[model samples]
Target chain A: MINVLVGSTVLPGNLEAVLEIYRELVARTRNEPGCVSYELLQLREDPCDLMLLECWLSQEHLDAHTRTPHFVEAIAQLEMLETAAPALIYTKSV
Target chain B: MINVLVGSTVLPGNLEAVLEIYRELVARTRNEPGCVSYELLQLREDPCDLMLLECWLSQEHLDAHTRTPHFVEAIAQLEMLETAAPALIYTKSV
Candidate 1:
């Protein structure tokens, strides 16, 4: 599996909006052919933070997902935050 | 500021062992002078997947944390995982 993990720190009040965007991202991602898993995680103590994870069968699917309209829009929204452009890492399964 | 994010897929049966170890990490991290925040988040859909997020006041603090005994212990434990050596990225706040 190829795992893409992203963490973004949002303005305290913008978390809800940010998550709403992710919900769309996840919903669409689940229908993609190589998507193994998609999840959104929140800090129990700090609700303002969010972690987004997407596991794919291959890098091809991940690249496709990034090209979608939802991702384009999502990337655009990054500028709306106090801090965005999440830390992204790709993990290759052992 | 510096953010270090790591995510690992634990063997279904080994999630407990992994998290128990992380508890020690978080406990010690909170006491470190430049540790701004530390959180362990699990995927709601895939509980075996874990994401570790650590925000430090600077890269200096992160380097110091890595030199500590607990982190060395954590590094050792990573070798125990079915999948380890998480994809690490250092994010600079923009």
Candidate 2:
């Protein structure tokens, strides 16, 4: 399986907007084929800090997710709310 | 529950050593009280990049984990093998 860790920092005053986007994106993404898990976590120390923990059956599955409407829309919305480019770490079980 | 995401980069030629430490650590940690899940993931693009996805029942449970012998030993060993200090994100389900 493929695992994706996405670290994002929301711009000042954009935390609620970012969370709304994530709520929709996560709900839609979880039902997609080959989605093992899709979770959104907010840092306890700083709510503006968000992390997405995603697991997919394979690289192909993850690629397909990126092309889905929910994923594409969420990224566009997040881009505006984010402080900078999100840090993405693609991995596999060790 | 409390979630902790740890990001680490291994020093040059220390991937094997780091993995050994994690193997032992994961095994021991899973058996600890209130450990809901503990996973180690290695980046697909860069093996040196590692991420730990951990879940515990509560803040107190996670605090107890850090004081455990296995955790303490693993941290000491990992500190020598890591390129720099690890990035830690303490979070809760959103």
Candidate 3:
């Protein structure tokens, strides 16, 4: 499986906006083929910090996700509200 | 629920040792009370980078886990093999 940890820092006043996008993105992404899990987490220590824990069946599935309409739209919106580019760590089970 | 993302970088030549430590840690931690999930992930881009994805019922449960013998011992051994202190991000579902 392909596990992805996506860490993003929201802009000072854009938390709500970012979350709105995620609500849509996550809901849609979860229904995609090969999606095992797609969860959103907000940091307790730093409210601006958000993380997406995603699991996919394979690299092809993950690649397809990136090109999907929901992903493209959500990412564009997220980029505007985020402090900088999100940090993505692609991983596999140890 | 309390979710934790722990990022650790292993020292060169210590991957096997670190993995050994985690094998014990993950197995023991899974049997602990209030442990919803405990998984280890290794970065695809950087083999030395590892991440722990954990979920618990509450902060109290997580605190208890830190005080457990298995946790303490495993952490001690991990520190010796890791390049630096792990980065812990405590979180809650958004």
Candidate 4:
């Protein structure tokens, strides 16, 4: 499986709302084919900093996930909430 | 539990040595009092890029881990192998 971490910094006042959106998105994402695990984590030092740890069967599976309606919708909302673009890192199991 | 992702870029030609060091460190760290999980993951696109996903019972537990002899030794070696200082992000479980 492929491991991916997507990091984003949410605007100060938008964390709760953005978190709700992520909750919905993660719920939907877990049901997609090839999804092994998906979780949203909030930084303790800066609660507005968020990270999503995702495990998928393959790069293709991940690409497909990005194309889904849930992803598209979530990304649109997340873009508005984000202070900057997300940082995505893809890794393989050791 | 506290979730921490520590990201680092290894100096080229140092990946194998660093990975071995990490393997040993993870083995030792897993036995630490508050360590829930400690794993090393390498970026698929850039093998020299590494990330360590760590789970600890509390910030105090994490701080203690940092002071351990094994940690001190491993970190010293890691510093020499790293292209830059590691980026550490601590988050709470959602």
Candidate 5:
């Protein structure tokens, strides 16, 4: 499987906003072709952080998704996030 | 957070082979910059499946890693895997 993970720290009072973003991301990915699973997870012990798993059939499909206009727009909107550390990764297992 | 997940089906008699691949992948990635957490996870209920979480700093960092020779070399070795389904993803949560 190919996996994509995006993580962010939630602002003190922005839990609702964080949830909204997560819900939207999940809904958007679930119907995509080759999407085996899309999971939005919060660290059980770390209320301030969240992680998402995007599982797809191949690197090519994933790359295509990342380049879509929707994804580009999402990034633009999230640029104002108040978190300290944010990350995105693309990886394949050995 | 940046998350990279990789998943695969384990071959019927290749348990040791699978473990060796995981060990090496973990060792090679653990020290990389912006790598906050690298986990090799075998599904609790699915003996034939495995998942890995490669949490890193940013999209740029992840993209660079994907372009590295090691990742390419790893791919060549795994091309012979006997799994029915293999997948990859690149995603950013909204």
Candidate 6:
């Protein structure tokens, strides 16, 4: 499996709005083929910071999800709400 | 709980040696007070890359663990095997 960790920070005062979008995005993402697990986490100390952690069956599976309509829409919406570009790392399970 | 995700890269051919150190570290860490979970994961695609994902009762608890003898010892050994500084993110649950 491939483990993906992404850290995204929302613009000031837009945490709720951004999280709502992610709620929908997460719902859709979890149903994608080869998606093993998908979760959205918020930082307790820094509420503006969020994490998207996912486990996928393979890189191909993740690539397919990124190309989906929901993913595209979420990215477009997030561009305006994010304080900075998200930090992402992908690790393959040994 | 505070979730800590750390990504560490081992020098070429040092994966086994580092993992052994971590095996002992993980065992000791799991026994620490306020430790919720502690795990060491290796990247399947990039065997040299490793991840230490932990959940602690609080930041104070984590700080305490870092100051412990086992942690201090592991850090000394890891300094020689790590190729790059680890990437760390601490997230609070919402």
Each candidate's DockQ: 0.05, 0.61, 0.65, 0.54, 0.06, 0.33
Could you tell me the TM-score of chain A in candidate 6?
A: 0.89
Across A1-94, the per-residue lDDT of candidate 6 in tens digits comes to 7777777888658888888888889899999999997877776667787777778999899999999999999889988997544434456432
User: What docking class should model 6 receive?
Assistant: acceptable
TM-score of 2: 0.90
- TM-score winner: 3
lDDT of 2 at B45: 75
Q: Rank by TM-score, descending?
A: 3, 2, 4, 6, 1, 5
Cα lDDT tens digits for candidate 5, B1-94? 5555566677758766766766776777777777776766554345556666666777677777667676666566665663524333333343
Q: Model 6, residue A34: displacement in angstroms?
A: 3.4
What are the per-residue Cα lDDT tens digits for candidate 2 across A2-85?
888777888658888788888899899999999999898888878777778888998899999999988899888888888544
For candidate 1, list the clashing residue pairs, or say none.
none
Please give me the DockQ of candidate 4 compared with the native complex: 0.54
Q: Find the 10 residues in a row with the least total lDDT in model 6 chain B.
A: B85-94
CAPRI verdict on model 4? medium
What lDDT score is found at residue A7 in candidate 1?
63
Q: For candidate 2 chain A, which ten residues in a row score worst on lDDT?
A: A83-92
For model 2, the docking class works out as: medium
Best of the two (4, 6) by TM-score: 4
iRMSD in angstroms, per model: 11.6, 2.1, 2.1, 2.3, 11.1, 4.1
Please give, for residues B1-94, the per-residue lDDT of candidate 6 as tens digits.
Answer: 7777777898768878888888899999999999997876666567777777778998899999999999999989988988544445456432
TM-score of 5: 0.48
Which pairs of residues clash in candidate 6, taking residues 3 or more apart in a chain or in different chains?
Answer: A44-B92, A92-B44
Query: How far in Å is the alpha carbon of A61 misplaced in model 2?
Result: 0.8
Question: B10, model 1: CA deviation in Å?
Answer: 0.4
Model 2 is docked with a DockQ of: 0.61
In the range B1-94, model 3's lDDT, one tens digit per residue, is 8788787898769999999889999999999999999988888888788888889999899999999999999989988898644555556564
Question: Candidate 3, overall lDDT?
Answer: 0.84
The CA lDDT at A26 in model 5 is: 69
The predicted structure with the larger DockQ, 2 or 4, is: 2
What lDDT tens digits, residue by residue, belong to model 3 across residues A1-94? 8788787788768888888888999999999999999988888878788888889999899999999999999888877788544455556664
